[model samples]
Target chain A: MSLSISLAINGQPLDVALDDPRVTLLDLLRERLFLTGTKKGCDRGQCGACTVLVDGRRINSCLALAASLDRAEITTIEGLAEGETLHPVQAAFIAHDGFQCGYCTPGQIMSAVGLILEGHAGDDPERVRELMSGNICRCAAYKGITEAVLEAQKAIADKSGAEQNRRDAA
Target chain B: MNRFDYVRPASVAEAVAAGSEPGSAFLGAGTNLLDLMKVGVARPGRVIDVTRLPGLDRIEWLPDGGVRIGAMVRNSDLAYDERFSRSFPAVAEALLSGASAQLRNAATVGGNLMQHTRCAYFHDLASACNRRVPGSGCDALEGENRLHAVLGWSEHCIATHPSDFCVPLVALDAVVEVEGPHGAREIAIDRLHALPGATPEQETALAPGELIVALRLPADAAAFSRNARYLKLRERTSYAFAVVSAAAMLEVEGGTILRARVALGGVAAKPWRAPEAEAALEGAAPTAQAFAKAAGLALAEAQPSGDNAFKIELARRIVARALTLASEGTPAAMPALPASPFSTKIGANHVA
Candidate 1:
């Protein structure tokens, strides 16, 4: 049985047809939409290589069925940057050398962004490490990854705080 | 994964009716279901998506001052909920200790309770697993059975239930609410999961097509809400299944124990409640010596395999420590312990 789902992907409306109901959000994004920035490591939910933001919440895309996510807003790694300017998380990854092979970088960054937005990435580095344990970096680049997340969290917080202040002044 | 038909029902009645169809399974969060499907363990012909069912995502307070958590409530939301965290600290801590942020965000309370075992043999299709295929033969019995069960395990299957929330829920005396073709019914959380008797495939007591609605915690348990603790001893600090976890709740009055409840995870086929330990702790002084004696009684009948013999001692120690921490009103977090020589031998793979 085929089904049609309407959803917004990275701010763009997408109408997708699923011939098989078992198609995952990760499969649809990578194979159908050609958004390969979200890597698929384990197909199973055990690994967080396919982490994506659905309605501003980080979730394992590999476990989410496309049909079940109708009308949901999805943000992959490709959607992070605006125009040519890199997202603060992307810039922090480069600054901190958070990747040895770059395979798990997209997932790590998405998870970090979600963590910061969820108000979980506090000043404590240990808390950040605990919250980011979902995304695995097999290269053992945890030190760099942890540093990158901390830096990005502060940058994002500062920017949001400034925006709030500007609005308050207005 | 197998080709399947999907139906997203708008109402609880519609969902239950659709779920009553043969070879149809209700889909919630899909964390474990998708993984099992990919591995050829579950082959449902139709999936009834119940996530869209309205009124099933609420966390409301009952009239008795207890809480009713909907089955559709995400693990992350319930863990971070101020009311839930305040009233059920052990449950919240256990929820956080189980999965990572990403998985918790995607996982639902009902889905976590219905998750299958993580026994390597059970996941391997080629291997003989009684839990997977009844009477096929139990491979984990003699082969790499380090993560297998030690308590309440039968010769048919020795797999352990890998839910952190369930341990504390059982200890809290929670009840599960479900709806089906008949009507709505409530089952105690401890009775929801069945021991691996002769039939390992029948893990849960829920009849087929009975949809879990919510879990209700009684108001009488409020006294131990702040005094409860959940201690998980895994291979690493995070994102790992428990080797032996303990959930302890003590109701003390003037330095004397009024009541005690303890449940264990990663030690048996289901959440194993330590009735003997609870009985031993009643009316006793809240001391380390009393906790040690109760902990010993909890593991008195434990039967471990060759590779998992250490879990017996591990479970006992964790129960004692968890009780001590609960008595001291300390939040249950990961405990620091000396390195174990048996960790490597027990296959502590860094999968996550």
Candidate 2:
């Protein structure tokens, strides 16, 4: 038996028949929708290569069953960009030379977005490293990743007035 | 991942009913379960998610002074909640130390208590594990067993419960409140997990359809809030599993010890509470020598295996340090140790 589920992927409606319960949402995204931007690292969920934002929180997509995530809004790296402009986190990653192989870039950016949005971005490099521990970039360019997240945090904080008004209205 | 029928229930009763299905399992925090499934370690026929249940995440302070933390309360929420931080600091510390930030955001208190062991043999399909397969022999006994349990281990299984949270919770005299096909009942935290005397597969006292609703910490723990810490030793300073750890709460009145509670992790199949150490602390002066003596008494009963004998010494030092730290007030953040290399090498190193 197949389960019919609807998800907003990258701001587009994704309605599909998830017939195989064994299939992870990561697998469904990569193999079926051809959204292979989310890399598959340590498929056992040890690494955060498959991290995605379900609604607003960062979740490991490898652990989620497509059938169980009915009507959930999901955001991957593909969703972070608006037309041609990169998300601030992505732009910062580039500016900070935040990656080497770039295989784990999508997850690193996704996690940093959630971290900054949740106000976990702090002044200390150690704090940044600890909070971003979930995403493992095998390229071992963590120093750059940590710096990018912190720098993006300062830039975002500078525009806090507009965001605060938006939040207050909501 | 194995094919499984999925059910999302809005109520505890509905969740318990779904567990009546032949091979169905609860799916609150899917970190452990789904990961096991993807790696071909677990293949449940069905899964029932109790995450969305309304009252399941509530942490209600009872009129009796105790707190009832709903099973669905996220680990991050549990750790940061002001009530938890004030009333039970060790529980909060344990919660924070258990996993990485991403996982803590998703992991629940009930799921932390119900996590399975991380035996290398169990994770690797090439090796036999009794916990994974009913009749299969456990290869960990004679195989690479540095992470395996050194205490309360049967000849069959030697894996320790991989949670950093359970040890402190059990020591704090917490009770597990569960609802099942039958009415609700409470079990002591210590009794919630079963020792692997013979049947290593039976890890928990939870029945087939019993669902853990909340864990209740005794009201008296608040009195000892001044002197409590969850000290962990890990392969890495962060996002790492405990190698040998101690959770201690020492109550000193005037210049003498009024009471002490100690429990150990990373050394046993179950959370090991040291009543002997607590007895040693009674009527003792608040001194480093006194703490050292109490720690020695705590390890008196420890039966360490060949490679893990260092754990006894490590645990002793940890308990002493905990008592010493508690003598001071709430400590500053623990200094991060130099994280060791990520190794595929399997051996018990007392480096931490």
Best by DockQ: 1
Candidate number of the best lDDT: 1
C-alpha TM-scores of all predictions: 0.95, 0.92
The sequence of per-residue lDDT tens digits that candidate 1 reaches over residues B1-352 is 8878888989888988888889998999999888888988889998999988999899999998999999999999998898787788888878988878999998999899888999889899999998899999888988999878999989899999999999989988899999998888999999999898899999999887899999999987777875888888888878888999998999999989999999899999899999999999999999999999999999999988648999999999999988987897844332211112122221232232
DockQ of 1: 0.59
Itemize residue pairs with steric clashes in candidate 1: none
lDDT of 1 at A105: 89
What is the per-residue lDDT of model 2 for residues B1-352, given as tens digits with 9 covering 90 to 100? 6677888887889999998777888987688888777678878898898888779899899998899999999888788787778778777777777777778878888888888888888888888888878679889878777666767887778888888889888788899999999889999999988888778889899999898999998889776788887778776657788888888887778988898888888887788888888888889888898889988987887775546777778888888877776677543332222111221122212232
What TM-score does the predicted chain A of each candidate obtain versus native chain A?
0.96, 0.91
Error of 1 at B200 (Å): 0.9
TM-score, model 1 to reference? 0.95
